[model samples]
Target: MRTLAAFFLCVCALPLWAQEDAGALAREAGAQLEAASVRLAEAESARNRVRALTDTVHAYEAGLSAMRAGLRRAAIREAQLRAQLQARDAEIAQLVAVLQTLTPDEAPTAFLHPDGPNGTARAGMLLAELTPALNQRAAQLRKDLSDVESLRLLQEQAAAQLQTGLTEVQTARSALNQAMAERTDLPQRFSEDPVRTAILIASAETLDAFSSGLASIVEGDVGWTPPEVDDLIGEFPMPARGVILRRAGEPDAAGIARPGILLATRPGTLVSAPTAATLRYVGPLLDFGTVTILEPRPGTLIVLAGMAVSYGKTGQIIAASTPLGLMGGLPASNGPSTGGEGGGAERSETLYIEVRENNVPMDPLEWFSTEQDG
Candidate 1:
């Protein structure tokens, strides 16, 4: 009986372990949203409004992400519990019937074996032990049912949270847009020469050729002292929150390999500069929809491409975590993107990051921090 009880406990534990404390997670989501709101308010009075708003926008994004995750888990857990209960309906009914027949006064006699006195003694002992185990199972059934109802309720209430989070994040992004536009603090490097750029674009045959000849298209000299990143060698900020689709030199489904890494992100996801850098080039290049090349130092360049809407123009000096652009797709203000980045068209928009040192391609993974701060 002890062994069987332990076995039942182990089996029950599987489903219990799969179930997260959704109420706690939902509360956490609310806390995240509240923090984001507070951050949004703080951004208004901060000396560096751009950076503050940027942080605020990211906070909202994180909140929305948490809300979505909580809701998704609740939905799955609720369904799992429901299915388990439903599949065990017949067994539950049989268990109830057996318990009903085992009245307190008559249960011992009903469970007693017909063999003899020795059999009767063993049967009585079995009845004594079985009663508690049956009671335990019945109690567990009630709890599982209660959990299912609670998860269902949590999911139903999540729509309001999602809507509020969506609206606030949109407001934050708009404020950030306005802030970035009005900013006059960042140092100016040099404006790009459109005539020379157009000529170079027309004549260049590849991204490498365009990047190699970019120095000639600059209309003026850059005098701003660029920020050094020696200490950030292995801890550079991630450009955006995403799932890595391919690492440097990894082949895609088409078997085409590139030196850069690719990230799968939700549409309209914010893409920020990994570090302080000057915008060397910001325009369309061959095959790549839109590209922004940043020169963080003398010999290094950070190339980010495939943004749906980019912010800064060529030659603008931007700081670390500054909003550079948005990934292709709808903004996070609309509806949150689901998991399974490997599927979904909206989640399919990718950001390509290439790091170069002295005009030579380097492993992008080495330069980017693995943490998802963006």
Candidate 2:
């Protein structure tokens, strides 16, 4: 009987020991899975960072190229103006010499003698003939002087532009270097699906279509949660600081109804992201100078147009208030002009800001600060 009881106890204990072993194995597997998930997230973050840096480097390069081109053009214009000015100066000198020769001397001469009436009459006729010629030369000198002044003004403007371009180029180069240094070794997000990308690129008819296709692909992930616009309302800042020249629904200079607000800013004004966003596109579009489109959240897009230079690349994530690029040349003078801060020289440029929801245009004024509405 004692032997039988001992056997029964050992058998019952075997099942409990087996259950404990199974539980321990399950816990170990769960811990390993959790660690893998963490590592994958870390890898994705690093990849995004490398991609952003690469895009920034590319943007700086593009900006530098544009600035170099502008500098070359300005140099050419300056040379032409200098040549014209030299020619005008030569013509003026010749006119002065002719005038000096035509003028009568202060001392008495044979023609000035009144002893013979023929001599005096001849002198009077000579004087009359010379009067018209003197007047003509005077008028020509005045016109030439005006042309010189105009040319001088142009040269001054060109010089200023050249200097600005040089400074910008240097700044962009530094930024490029920094970005390159910060870049990490990680695969780019876009390269993950080359086959689909190649197909889209081949099929897209226009840049707009291409951008739309890319946006769709980017937003296709089922886990993404778009931020509510209401939550961001009044919380975001303007991409650039300037006076509002035209509000949405108002007629623009071309007499077309504008879907965005046009802000009059100074040239080379730094443009930044109004909110945390992912860049969708950055390049020239038809009629709209260099443009940059950003998506702050899924289904919402913000468009910044009329920039002279654009920085940052497509698909790069940008934090709020991060520098995008500088505003390009001044816009057409048809837009309203407002004084800037500190009584500085008034320089005006038009920046078009548009916000779209699900690709439908919406008034950006509703989203911007009320204090900036003026």
Angstrom error of the Cα, residue 300, model 2: value is: 0.3
Model 1, 29-143: lDDT tens digits are 8789989988888888998898888888788777777777788777877777888889888767866765664474645566555787787777568667776876777777898
TM-score of each: 0.84, 0.43
- Please give the CA lDDT of all the candidate structures: 0.77, 0.55
lDDT for 211 in candidate 2 is 53
Model 2 Cα lDDT, one tens digit per residue, 13-33 = 422111112122223333333
Of the candidates shown, which would achieve the greatest TM-score relative to the real structure?
A: 1
Q: What TM-score number comes out for model 2?
A: 0.43
